[model samples]
Target chain A: MTGSPPAPASLPGDDLLNRIRALRDSPAATDTGLGRELGAVADPLLLHEAGRLLKGVAAARLTRAPATRATTLRVAVAATFTADDVVPLLRAALLAGGVDAELHLCPYDQLGVQLTDPASALAEFAPEVTLCLMDAGALLPRDWDPSALDGVRTAVRDRVDAHTAAAAGFAARTGSAVLLHTVPLPRPDRRSVISFRGGAALGRIWREANIALLAAGETRDGVYTVDLEALFADEPGPVRDERQYRFGRMAWTPAAQLAYAREAAAFCRAVSGLGRKVLVLDLDNTLWGGVLGDDGPAGIELGTVYPGDCYTDLQRRALALRRQGVLLAVCSKNERALVEETLAGHPDMVLRPDDFVAVVADWQRKDLHVAALAEELALGLDAFVFADDSPFECGMVAGSLPQVDVVALDGDPACHSTRLLEPARFAQLGVTATDAERTALYRGRRERHRLSTTHETAEEYLRALGIHVTVGPADAYTLPRLVQLEQRTNQFNMTGRAHGEALTRRLAGDPGHLVLAVEVTDRFGGEGVVGGVWLDRGPDRWTVRNLVLSCRVLGRGVERAVLQYVADTARAAGAAVLEARFRPTARNAPAATLYPSAGLTRAEGPAGDDETVRHEARLDRLPTLTPDWITLVAKEAPAHV
Target chain B: MSDTMTTLRPLVARVSHHPAESLAPDTRFTALGSWGSLAAMRLLAAVEQTYGVQLDLRAYMKLETVGELASEISTRLSGGAETHAG
Candidate 1:
């Protein structure tokens, strides 16, 4: 049985472990069986056991399964205790989340030393994410008077300041995202009765410290606080095992560690652009309690009633997601008029038809409808999440389009909202203003698509749409979207290089580099900043380091406009040669001949390296190429600069 | 074979990579070809989890055969409530 525990009669006690070890060692373990076995392990101790054994198996490289499409996340841990004790749990959690983790555990109580020193193991390891694990006890002063509230407050402030400064310094020095664990509140002791009566209690001090840490994360880039207090509060079992803590300095229980690791992996996935982007829902018994066609508007259970409130609450949850830039879509087996009427006329419906970027209400298969929606949104099938209450529909879509994350909504209606929000599939590290405006942008694209079909020729349609392109240097306001584009754009990117926020900031500020963001608008609406390009200027030559454009604006000649702007800028800067490189990737086949197509001469730079095709055009002989139908506006430089 | 032996035999056989029929109650873990430290830890965790008992660390370290491990689990199950895991 896949992902099911072996029958108790067949594998009892020691037999279960032996079977797991054998399965782990056998060739079949990695081939579709490991996930099942791991899923079957319901007991935390057994899970830990499986994790420990799997670590060795992973190290030995005995399993024959193909490697998952995963990023090898390098993580450095600096804690006040033996934090490496939970590394196995963390690895198991990361594996569960479809990520491979490489951990570097620094010496205990050496967080400051490792973070401050440039040549420390932490810096040398060059982790992409650094975790600073500290407990409340570490920050609390020893032998402090309980009545001295001001003194305790001052001490807490000092500790907070020191921790924030260390985290900021680490991020600046190593270019690593800092994940700070909020200090957990201490367990009740002899002072509990008095401390509970006073405002300046130990718990109060801990709370203030956590708030300060959270504020620190908000004020800095690539720094975030993981809420250990909230994690512990939600955990059903003991948050801390006193025995383990006293024996080996293990701060939290295995369950808590597992939860923390899952959160950390989610954060890492978000940072790496692996999180899901779309939420595709089914209508009948999915978004509402009943079918729109059969139940009709009044008969449908979707208001503030017992069963109706469940569906109503689900709709509100979906609306919340939409507000946070998660694109909503509908794929249901219903007539278009019925779906529209229910969405528009249903009294309990929190989501209107406008909330969804695409509504596929037809008799087509759910998988086909989802695929069409992905195409319409210009996103990969993996980016879509299909949720339906029907088991058959969920199974069909799951089997047909395995890339889509299928949430089979079963069980009581009361639990639907919780189920929908439980998976961290759509977790995001940070949401920019552009993210909030994504649904509107997609809506504008739909309008443009409709307008494109009215004209006979592409040029005629482009002229009729009144397209406008603005080319400008990247600034603080546009940097996030530019970095997001750099990280996420795969299909039309010339070189699939993910220049993160730190590098993008450096390039934008450096005089030797030129980074430009392209914003597109048409008569229908603005598509926001849809593309970006980065150029590294040498002494005599300007090389296009990266050029990425969103697929949403692909057919509208935005790529040509951006490329022409780059060439014009290079020619104006007195550069002798303008060069570009096209590094081919699996998804970047659309960009393979981009440089050559733009009239740049294809040339071989070095012998024996054929992966990157180099193309160059002499600035003196370059021809200016611009689209006549669209208006191009060059943004003026800031007056201060 | 006893019920405990029937239940423990498959686990031992699987871990030791021997035939299930080859295992007996007195089969020592040290004699098992694949019974290394890692395997032993895995065995300890699985047995504890499956039986809902926490074997004492000292007693666990002293275990050598299938019967000894099973006896330890039985004793723990009868003596006290299931121990909380960390």
Candidate 2:
């Protein structure tokens, strides 16, 4: 079947094809179409080709063909007549962000009656994502006797509560998420109509009711609430009679309502785990005003007024991604030295050569440039996206690859970079200890890779670096960083397991378990706590519960030092067998080969089931404990630093 | 070593918003930190009016240091601006 139709004001050209080729070539390539267009490249044909190539690459990566086509969410929506146009607009936003949702229109029919039966209807639907168009009247109920008004008040309130609660429960049960849209409460004094009873009445009750529903759902563990009141405070409003509905007092204008819905829909998609990973960028007309070969660095258009100011802002934003732990690499078609000089010497260019983790700025096919980037960065091909102003290049990548995510932006170039905030490309995990050292660390890795090419064998390259590895018991300061590493490191991670703050505290408190953090330092610099090991001791056995090594330190002989520490320490503690496990992942081939090389015997011990490869090594007979490259150093807690 | 230079310094070095030059004498204490709490307060009747965030007297007083006050004000201002833009 065909892919979902593109969103409104559809971007020009195909995005999926270029992304696929970029991904096939390199999982690390980012879609640069938007940034390049915004960066102001003038050649439309180049823009067309670049965008097409990007789309092809993106499509190939995403064609995983799930056995059962992923279910589209059943969304029950409710909104005021004033916000009638919002649902479809939101749907477009959600679809554009890759959320599979089918709207079940439950538009508000004068509010009170529509909300009364929400629970039974919502529970019957059992939606993966639930959106409550909350307002004040539904939340803050009127003080009326439940027995008198035919039980309407209590029934309405309870149903709204149950609907929200059920949605949250479904999310927590099915691993889906629920969101509540809380409309801003109309300011009371501004909209209050004077009654003969001498009290001025405002329409804020509708907004308050929504918040009450949100609060009721929040009391339970699963439901998450969004504060729309905070979102629409300064939004423009539709033209309304000042005497009716409190006019200027309303927080949102019709235009603002549309904007708010679009933004909310994007957020829902992001939090739901469907986001873009890579952001391929271009050089020459894209990175700066003129071509790098022609502009001669100092004469380039970046870092000045209007168009130049835009690139500066974009660079500043790219740098912020480091804090979020997004790896950045270069895929510009330019002379490597010229691009390097512009990055370093141009005062206007905020991004330096060190900012990108890998560079593929050669005259070869764009498809090949992306492929090399993936190998260098060690990311999956499907996770790539390419953006370029050149549609031809985009089409080339798309036709060549077909699984990468390619976004070929159309319209004004200045606003292209800002669109990078689209919800579909969100990565959920927060920053880890590895994030702070990313740019410099990746730059160091790239240097090592470049240096390795000159040597004949991999061992010769490894021996050249004066590498030192230190392994010891994790203490107060080290535990926080270790926990952070466990939560973020993907490749070389045993099970892709993650831990939170509470779990970190518990790990430190458990005396039976030992947490070891390994420090690696090479010729370039000191890589702080690049490896972590969690060991659980039970009588005569020591089990390795969690083991992860940063990709930055992989193949550097740090893994051996870590295991040796465990074996010797276990022997000292009087434990017998040291069992190490190997779990396979698409990006962890290096780790799958680790166990066999460590001299542990693999056994197939099960019938009626596929045998998991397990390694058994007796701690007592483990070789004469000599930490060849590692020297056990008693370092103070990192906190004191 | 020069008594004349030392005594006339404060009168000569009064700073302004100009980029590291053209500072006037008696240009006010804003030289330490620009658009600070005191200056913000002077600009508007209350913190609630000048800033998007409502400020209690205790909250205002906690900004004892000039730089801290500037940072607090800057954070609130930026947050307010972001909420408005959103």
Candidate 3:
């Protein structure tokens, strides 16, 4: 198998048939490959047919070899009915979501025994997660009538408690996480109660029973419950088909299976700690209706109107995710200044610049920038998910960073939010707010950017905001962040070397090397330790090893003040010249112009090798000074040799 | 092949992993050792979904030949209710 095949233009006629046949013929037929193809089919009947074809190949593959990948998860599924067909569907879903699960399925109606008994084969299998699937018809007694409401209530309570106790007991005994779902009440059962009043009472009892199921999961440590009825309510669908249920023992329809399979995959990933922590969005057709460069701010479709309302809904969804503590960021291919101006002043935009943790809006490979973001946030690449409307960009990011989950949005902005969140890619159970301060910082949005229209110049706005900065020597407290800046900073980093804690300490503590930590605070909030400066205090000329600042503090004058402080300290320490090196990276073009903007003269002749350009300013001349708008606090005295 | 047979052969072939040409009107679904209940139900589902008719389990159990399933589907498609069971 060519792992995951390139998605076809359209998936109905010869194209879809050929893909199914090709995947069926391949020797490396995996559940992931089959599921990926299954995602393309839209119609329910066609989806089932394609799923069957692809699942046939995967079933044969499943029997041949056991999964040995590090991504392989050990899962045990115990369902009440004949769920032989369910095994393949779950396998496809889990594998496509990048989990190779070694599934252990119990015999029919063996859910309780398989869960509770230590001597059982399920115990022998010793799964990491046990999924307990249920059916309401199977739980309720066959002879029971809905006429006696009290008898109905008693039977429901006993059955529901028994099922939950078995699942919770299994979790306690085996230490494997258990996943259960709210059983959708059969429509026939509801319609059995002829009177409207009786039907409502029956519905209320079933709902309370399902709530008990959910509440039971909340009390237990290793058990999780998903509300299938809630899901069925949100999504339009029939819960069951009488013929299928009676004949095939499949209580749920294809729609129910598809929905449950998706949520199950997300639950398995979330409990395994593989859920995404960051959602990287594209700007052009994703955030708005058109391209920012091609269609100017006013020209874009992003207000409260026909097509633009779709984009606005998506922004609201992203804002909701951020409120739940999932950090939002942008990795787009557009001009940074244009993006900033739009993000700051676009009245139609629901998401402001303050919403994003990092905005990498320059023309760089999105994969590289996403990786940089993961490093800057001190997280793993697996914790990030990238969503884009362009298939080209999605393919690139998916190819380069296979760990990151890719949500490919299509032409319809209406479906974008649903596609992005339906998988519950960023959903988690309990979010411990480890950084309460960070959460508080993001609580209130700074409306000053929206007020930029009133200010005559950008400087006047800056002056009104009252920005403050403190540049001091790096101590034990700020060394880790400084080292992170050295490793992670790209655009504003003067030197792109792999620096470790040892070198950072030598720069901070040693007399010859000086490391400065720049902290920033504005009228909005406090941004802790946003910039770093590493310098070599030479006899006659001070050399700058690295000057890296967080992109969050860019457009502000914090970086300029840090540079000025380095120059002033070096000159007072008897250095004749302040020299700096500009090393170029694919992402560091913004850094290339910084030296000249600070009034440093570029050395003409050869300026070192192909990569590094030399910039020097005579300490006696001291052409640049910190701007008055950014007030620098007097901290550590300049330590001279 | 009849139009019913044309559609029936392919569906049975897909579920049973046997070629369409291998199926005929007199073929018993259980004649092949590999043909299990699961495959039978899938074929039943495919038929039900394609023809938009429900084949009762009792009627389905009595089915022994591929030709009988076609006649049963035809009976339901002809606006009759469980009339072909006997």
Candidate 3 CAPRI category: incorrect
- Which tens-of-lDDT digit does each residue in A1-641 have in candidate 2? 13532222212232432343455488755443333231232222223233223332322123321111123445555443333334544543443344445655454433333334445454456554555554444443445332333343344457466556555555444333456655554444223434522222223333344666668545543355666666565444432212223321222333454555555665554443234445566765555566777768877777658777766666676667645555666677789888777777777777777667776777888877776766555544445666666777777777665545555533445775765544336454234465567656656666777778898987778777667777877766566567656644667776544433334445546777767788887787777888888777877888776688977677667787777777877887788888766656554566776667776767556422352455768886676443354454534434321
Clashing pairs in 3: none
TM-score (0 to 1) of chain B for each candidate: 0.80, 0.32, 0.86
The C-alpha TM-scores of every prediction are 0.84, 0.55, 0.64
Candidate 2 lDDT score relative to the true structure: 0.53
B26-75 in candidate 1: lDDT tens per residue? 77888888677545654654565456666665567788888777676666
Give me the iRMSD of candidate 1, please.
8.4
- Interface RMSD for candidate 2 relative to the native interface: 27.5
| Candidate 1 deviant stretches above 4 angstroms | A1-42, A49-71, A100-109, A141-152, A188-195, A198-200, A450-464, A599-615, A639-641, B1-73, B80-86
DockQ of predictions, in order shown: 0.22, 0.01, 0.13
How does residue B45 of candidate 3 score in lDDT?
64
Top lDDT hit: 1
DockQ score for model 3, please? Answer: 0.13
What does candidate 3's lDDT look like per residue over A57-139, in tens digits? 43334322222122346788888876666665666566555566777889988888888788999999987778888988656
* TM-score-based ranking: 1, 3, 2
- Candidates 2 and 3 compared by TM-score, better number: 3
